[model samples]
Each structure stands twice: as C-alpha cells, then as structure tokens.
Target: MTATVAIDSYFTPVPDEIEAIDLVVEGALPPELNGRYLRNGPNPKPGAPPAHPFVEPGMVHGVRLKDGAALWYRNRWVRTSLFTESATRVRPDGSLDLAACHANTHVIEHAGRTFALVESGLPYELSLDLDTVGPCDFQGRLTTAMTAHPKADPVTGDLHFFGYGVRPPFLTYHRLSASGELVQSVPVEVPGPTMMHDFAITEDYLVWMDLPVVFERTELGVPYRWSDSYGARLGLMPRKGGPVRWFEIEPCYVFHVGNARQDAAGRVVLDAVRYDRATFRNEWDLAAGKEKTGSVPGQMLHRWTLDPRTGVRSEQQLDDWSLEFPTLNENLVGLQNRFLYLVGGGSVVKFDTVNGERGVHRLPDGAKPGEAVFVPAENARAEDDGWLLTIVSNRIAGTADLLVLDATDVAARPVATVHLPRWVPSGFHGSWVPESVVR
Candidate 1:
C-alpha cells in the first residue's frame, strides 16, 4: 500500500470545532477594539489529504473582542453544497456547480453581511458569529464566481472585484454599490486563462495582471503551470468600465497587492509582492507536496509605475526581504497610503512606503504569525492609527496566541496577547468587523 502523505504544518486540520470562552489576555486590549476577527483557510477532512492546499474545504476561525476583553474563540467549516452532498454532483452542461465552492480563501464584511469567498464559486455568507448562512449569489445577479480579494473604496463605499475562469470570456469585472446591490458586471477581454489571483484599483483605473501562469487540463490537483510562451501583461481599464489598454511587463506573479494609486504626473503606481516564474512554479509544486529541484527564490516587495499616455512602464523592487499577504489601511484604499503591512520572514512587518523604512514584530522562535488584519480605531485620524491582529502559532509549545499590535509602532511588543485553547494553522485573508457594522 502507498504510504499516507505526512500532513504539513498548514494542512493539519483541527480535530473538532472548539470554543474557548474568556480567553486570558496578557496586555491591555485596546478599548476601541470591539468586534470579531475572522480568518478563512483550507482545512481538509481527517485522513483525507487534498491534492493541493488550495482545493481543501474551507474552515473559518474567529476571535471576538469587546470592552477590551477577548470574549470567545470559535471555528466552523463553511457548509457549501460541495460539503453537503455525498455523491459526485455536476451540472447537466458538464460545468461544475460554482455554488458548491469551498469558500476558503477570505472572510470579508460588506453592506452589513459577512461573506467567505473562494475564487471558483459564489461567496458563502456567514453570520456575524461565524456560522455559515448559505451561498449568496447577490440576489441572483452574480453568475460568475466572486473574487476573494474585493476592494471596497474608502471614499465611495463601492466594492470592486473581478473573476477569471479557464474558458472564453475568461475575465469579468464586477461592481457593487454601497447598499450591497450588484450594480454592474462587464466582460473584459483577455488573451487566455491566466491565474489572476489579485488586482489593484487606482483613483481612475482598475489594474489587471495577465501573467504567464496559464491553466491547463489535468486529472489531478490545480492544473495551472508557468508558461513561457504566454507573455506577461497588465491591463488598465477606466474605473467606469470601458476600453482596456494593455502593457507588457517582465514575467512575474503577484499573489496579493499592497496598494495602488495615481501619482502627480498621472502615472499609475502599483505595489505588491512579486515572484518570478521559476519561484512561482516551485512554490506551487512545494505546496502540493511535489519534490522540486533547485533553490526557491523569495517573493520581493515590488512596484510598477505605468504611464498610460506614453505607454511607458517602470518597475523596481522596494525591499530585499521576502514577504506576502500585504495589506494597507482600508480607509486609504485606492488612494495614496504611506504604509503597508505584511507577513513573512517569521514576523509581521510594517513597511513605510514614503520613507522606505520598516518596523517588524518578530514572533518568538518556533512561532509563526498569519496574515495581520488591520482594525481601524473609531474615528481614526491617521492611517496607521489602529491595531494589527494576527494569530501566532507556537509549534514547539503546541499553542497559539491572538496578538494585537499597535499599528503606529509595530516593532514594539504586542499591546495584548490572547491565549488560545489550541494552535491554529496558518491561513488566508481575514477581516475585522466593528460592532457597529455587525449590528
């Protein structure tokens, strides 16, 4: 018999759904930090190893905070149609049911509703308490899958996102009004089925990454592989959704975008963590438990400036350190922001975009912190005037801590550390829903 694959640190699913009440807090919790911090990630069934991390079913882990206290911690698997059915189900047309998605990539709140999102299917709505509500199709308007990384304009409250598939009409842009109505869905022309994980939005334009990572037909895991023949390009389309102008760039893959905005000269500036073709493929294979040869290059914080009028593009690396899961203050989305928060290199780093300096909150040896979620202070005045919440797992101690750091001074010690009952595996994107928004 084939030996069972050993579970990686991230693929170790919790044995049971757990709830720990009245968690011990080490430091003082910020009074304004009132609400829930929910993060979604893949957690496969026990003894059922998935072909890849991305295909595992989604489980959401969350922590509730109010009145400067850690109220409770809870985790639940998102119940999609895929999780409920016993037999293999497919549509009559041969297309997989998008509603049956794992809903594992991200957890976000918009228009008073919380949604767990995966790029391959419709979003699964969850209750404020982190319980799965059901799959939401935006009142039957969203025919295509919703992106995991949807940007909500801080000024207009409008949500902007897009979805890509393996077939023709491969990409489509979506817009939702502040009131939660699906206002528009426009089909965008692209060359082929590229794995467009995340995009960016500036004040006047929406940026699209059409890299060389193309989807191929395979019987096993995710069928995406790096293609040299498929060129790398970026598409700039007006915010109002019109014609798109494309510009070629050096081949690279960006899993997440820090922020984007237009400079004084009307050039579009974009910041993200970039991985080269070889690094991207090797990492992909490593995540799938496949052996790879050669050293794996790290993802660097990179920037690109595009001048639409002259069709000139400039690229540069912002830092030498490796990082991923970059986030900025939501209030500064689509606008000029001075700081970017990221997780990698065994710590949570605050990058000063303006001064090119960095502040880091390094985890203890043998501990790893997940993506840092920024919780803005009530009536905040400055961009970094908030708290950064992240789940730190101590592999040696077999425990985890909900770490809260002052956004303004991340390098200092954590303001509060909530001791968790169990260790939580590293996961994807999360959101901090204020109490007012929950109500």
Candidate 2:
C-alpha cells in the first residue's frame, strides 16, 4: 500500500477564507509601508490534495497597510480554472490547457499589473484586493509554461523569464518589455526536460541551470530524482542574441537564487542555495510525504563566477548552515548587492557576502517563517536600508503575523507585527506590492 501524503503538519491547509479589518498591530508600523504584503502558497482543498505539497491549489494571503496602520487582512484562493472549475492542463484531444493551472507559487507585479504565478502554466492576474482576474498569455504569443521565478531588470524595466517542459525544445526564454508587451520568445537549447525552476540575470547576460532532475513516467508525477549520468551545467546566454555558452559545474539542485550580477571584470557572479544528491532526494521525499531516507545536510549557500572569454570559472560553498528563500533588494537584482536575506528553520538570516558575516533573528519556539522579502526604505541610504517583510506562522496558536524587520539589523526587534486572523500554511514565493507602484 502507498503511504499517504501528510497535510497536518506546518503546511496544513486552511479550510475556508475569511477577512478581518482593523487588525491589531504589536509594534509601530512605518508610515512609509503603504502597500500590501502578498504571499502565495499551496493550500489544497480539504479533501483534494495533490501528489506533492508544491502542486496543490494556490491560496494567497494579503495584509494591507496604510499610514502606519494595519487596515485589513484577507485570504483568497487564486481561483484558476483548476481550483474552481476542476480544469486540467491537457484536454481529451491532447491539446494543452495552460490556463488550467495552479497559480500557487508566487505573486509578483509588472507593468502595473499584479499576478499569481506557478511554473507549470501562465500567470493569473490579481487585483490589489487579492482577487484573481485571469490568466495572461501576452496576446496569444506565449506558447509554453512560465516559470514562477521571473527576473525583472532593474535598469531596463524589462522582465526576463523562461519556461521548461517534458517535450522537445525543453527550455524556452521569454521577455516582456517595460510596457508589458511580450517582445521576445527564443527557444533555448537543452538536452532534455528537467525541472528548471529558477534562473538569474545580469546587466548583459542570462543565467540557466540544467541539472539532473529529469521527467519520466512514475507513480508520483514530476518526480525530482537525481541522475549521475545526466550531469550538471550552467549556461550563459547573451541578451543581444547568441547561443547559450554552457559551463560544466558541480552536480546539485537549486530551487531558488539569491541574486546574480556582473563583476568589474565582466564575469557573471551568482549566489543561490544548493542541494546535493542525497539532500535533494531526502528533502524532496519529505515534501512529497514519502518515507524519509538517510540523514543529509539541508540546502546551503553557494556561489559561482563564470567568464565568457574562457570557459574557466570557480565554484565555492558560501556557508554550511541550512537556509532557503534567498532574497535581496529588487533594485540591485542584476547589479551589485552586498547583502542577502534568507529564511531558516526558525530564524531569519542576513548575509554580508563580501565579509562572510551573518546576522540572525531567531523566532520564538514553534514559529515557522516563510520567505523574507526585502522592501527598500523610503529614505534608503545603504544597500541594506530596507524592511524585510515575511509571514511567520505559529501552528500551536493557529495564527500568523506579518513580521517586518529592519534589513540592516536582523538582530534588532521587529519594526512592526501585524496580527493575522488565521494560521497561514507554508507557501512557496510572494511579492510585496507597494500601492504606489500599482496605480
């Protein structure tokens, strides 16, 4: 008999959606934080769970802040064709239904539009109030699935993203202009289909990871198993148009990237969390509610510097401590960013990449923190001058909080704590939608 996937742990799905106004604030909220802290995660319906925790229907939790006050908090399902109408991505005739997706991974904004995203299909737009509008295909131009981890160029205002699948032309790169027009969609050449979740970008180049996690027929769909023979490599493609320059690197799996930038020497440097063979399989099994295996280390901070002139490069393990959900200041996405913020088991860490210093904020017992999103301060003076916005959930209390901490000093007390009405399940990725950027 097959073991059942557990949903009663920290990731238990909330049964219903509710709203609360005039939320109580524990600490002083900065008047400048006039926006919504929106997060999306998998929240499978009560009787309807997916094969894994990551593929369930998506539910978005949002907290609205205005003028130093917590105005309201609301939770809404993304209401995709899958969530509401029980739609499937493939039709009876084998046609693909990209709109029938679970937009349950991340929520981001571009070209004045907010969207809920999952890597398997098109994005579903959401209103400021957290209501799903619909799927966006850039005027029928996007023929493939969109990865949840799209990078928006800080200087160019252009969006860089890619999509991968089980079919040939396994990887495709797409770009959207500053005004939201789908400008370019190029077929990136990869050997076969892999779980290409995330990528990075610098001022002049795009970063791609072609790891060993391949797709095949299995009891659990889209199994993330490691393959020694497939090998691992990172690719660098010119934004102007050129074939991807592949660099053979260490074998590992990366679910997220902290940031990537170009050094003064014109080489591309990238920071991200890495998982080895054992660790990736172990973690993947635990997430799928399968039986856990041998003890292995969790994800670690790793870096890679690649040069175009010569295919030579250096790889380094930045840290041994386990961490995930790496984030940095959006303005420095593909530029010089010295500070990186991440979430650990029960604490948040701020890593100074240049000096190898780490500042941590340990939460109270039984508190699980989600991704830490960096929002630049109104009077920002330094690279770390911002507020780290994250959702902390306490399962014992059946509640959660929108915790805001100063980015420069993670050890310092929270800048504000907006009390949420109910407990929020551990979700994937989200965005802090500042109201000023919307209208």
Candidate 3:
C-alpha cells in the first residue's frame, strides 16, 4: 500500500478567531469604499486530523473599511452543525440534512441579508458583524442545496444558481427575486451525475457545463472523478423557461467562468480556465495529499463560442497564464464585459477583451494572493474603473494582508493595504458588500 503524504502547509489555518481594530494601513483607502470584504474557506479545528480539503470546516475572515480607514479585521467560523455539533447529515431514517453544511465556499449579501454558502447544503445566514445567525431555507421554500456561485442579474436583480446531487433530480435550476424570495425551481435533465462546480450567465440564458467529471461511489465517501466515457457538453437554458439546447464541446473541466454573453445572432461566448484529464487528476490527488504521477500542466484561459442556429461550436485559447478564481464586475454579470480578473503565479491578472492585453500585478517574494475581487468605483464609467481586493498571505512570516489595487492598471501599486492581525488561511470566494446594500 502507498502512504499518502500530508497536506501542503501553503495555506495553514489559524487555530482560534481574533479581532483587531484600527489596523495599520498603507497608502490611501478609497473613502468611497465603505463596506466589508468577507472571504470563506476550509479550516479544520485545532487538533483535528487533516482531511480532504473540501471536508474541512468553513471559516470566514473579514476586514471592514469606512471613511478611508481600516476599521477592523475579524475571523469567525460559521458554527454549522459540522462545527458546533460535529454532526452528520445522515439521520437514523436515512434522510439527509440539507442544513448540515460547512458553509465554507463563499459569502455574499443579497436583499439586506448575508449568507455563508456551500455547494452541497443550505446557505447559513450571517450577521453584519460576522456572527452565525443559523441555517436559512428561505422560510421553508428551498428544498435543495444552493450553489455558491449564484449570479445576481444586475438589471432584474434575480439571483440565478443550480444544485446537483447523486440521486434523482440530479440538477435543479433556481432563481430568487430581488427582495430575496424563492420564486422559481425547475428540474434540469442531464444524462448522468457530474461535478458541476460552477456555471455561467448571459443576457437571455444560463450556460451549463456538463463536463467529463462524473460522480463515483468510493469506500470512504462518494466523490466525483474524471471519466473519459462521460463526454462533454454545454447547454443553454432560457430565463423564461423552455427546453434546453445543448451543444457538443471538447472534453474539458472548468471550475470557474470569467464571464459570458450572448449576441443578437444567438451566439454565446464563454471565457474560463480549462483543465484536461491529467491536469485535473494531478490537482485532485494533490488536494488528497497523494503523490503526483507525472508532470501537471497548468490551467489556461479558453474561449468557447456556440451558435445555436447552425449547431456549431468554435473554441480558442485566450491566454497561457495558469489561472483560477475568475471574477468581474457584478453589475455586468450577464452583459458584455471587457475586463476580467484572475490570480495566477502569485499575481493578479487583468485581461482586456477589446485590446487583447494582459495586465499583471506580481506579489512580493513569498507572498501568495487569493482571488482579485472587482469592486466598481462610485459612478464608474469604464469597465475597469474599480478596485481589485485580495488577501495576500506570507507563508514565511505567518501573516496576511488585505491588498487594494487600481483595477485600471493592475500592475500599478496597490491603492491600499491593511495589515491584518492574524494569519488568514487562503479561501475560496467572497463579496464586497457595500454598507448601503446591507443596511
């Protein structure tokens, strides 16, 4: 038998939560940026054995900014059933507890309410001060797990997302109103169960990636694995409800979508990072603390254009940089977006679709940065007229800092830097909730 190696210390979690006020700041923080930057990720409790990266409990780190000052920095666990009770979702009657979630994937605010979300369970409500308010099922209307990558339509204010399980009704599409009411739930038909991490959106449709990664039952627990026979496809579901139109695309996996849009000609274009079979397996094994079999290729930006009228699909490689955690201005969620941001090779990369230029902001030595979240400037005119917010952690010094850079020129010096009081483990996704939105 082969022994598994230990998880990488690249992102070590701090044992306890802490808070600090009036943190030291470098450079000028935009006074207009009066909000909180909250991030969530996997963090096992102290003395807990290392488990699969995704199985760890969820923790959120937040930094508040107001009137050009870094007001406070706080980190808190979601206090889910997993955290507080060490409970299992499986009941004695074999029913599943949808609320027994780690709530570790992302944090966002909608309709004056904030939620900590995971892909496999109900979203956990959170207070403005980062306290857990308990599990929320939209007043008993939500019967399915919610996707952490929900997209709020800037024009209509509808939140679009989906959930997948191993049983019947594998994939279900859902939508929430601007006031945070559950309005629509439709079962989406897929040939088989696959790991659908994220999806995309356009003006008139929602883009779905049915890739090669399929679910498999393992001895320990059921997990998704790459399958050559499962095939690959991209489907288009109308917002008003109708039959889905799926297009055949090359077999690949996309964990994140940068942005997507549809033209008047019924042509849809999606930009995201693609990983082949070997690359994904390498990543999967690494997260499991297993030895790599061979060289692991990097993830690159790929563009897919599907034309429904002619039943044709064209694809291209957009960039060679290894990337992840793609993000853009939320206001342009389903619209034509010119600027997209991602992090790779210890830098924040900004891509301009019109000019075909890549702007990069490389971090200092030994400092690793998380996703570069785009926050649009007040009364912003240009697509890149915003700030790029990220948490930069130094593995060597056991420290973390909040970095704010000008979106127009990512390679430029940061607009502000807030020195955090504790070492924040690298996290998944978060939101920049303006004070007005949550108030």
Residue lDDT tens for model 1, 243-274:
98889999998889999999999999999999
- For model 3, how does the per-residue alpha-carbon lDDT over 1-439 read when each residue is reduced to its tens digit? 1112232365577778888899999999999999999999988899987677676789999999999999999899999987898778878899889888789899999898999999888999999889999998888988888888999999999888888877768899999999999988899999988889899889888999999989896432437789989899999888778888999888999988988898778799998889988888887777666788877788888899988678788999888777889899988987889888999768888987767689999997667899888999999999889999999877766678899999998999999999898677788888898999885
Candidate 1 wrongly placed segments (more than 4 Å): 1-8, 86-89
TM-score for each of the candidates:
0.96, 0.96, 0.96
Name the TM-score of candidate 2: 0.96
How much is 46 displaced in model 1, in angstroms? 1.0
Worst 10 residues of 3 by lDDT: 1-10
Query: Root-mean-square deviation of each candidate, in angstroms?
Result: 3.4, 3.6, 3.9
What is the C-alpha local distance difference test score of candidate 3? 0.87
| Candidate 3 local Cα displacement, residue 393, angstroms | 0.8
Q: Write out the backbone clash pairs for model 1.
A: none
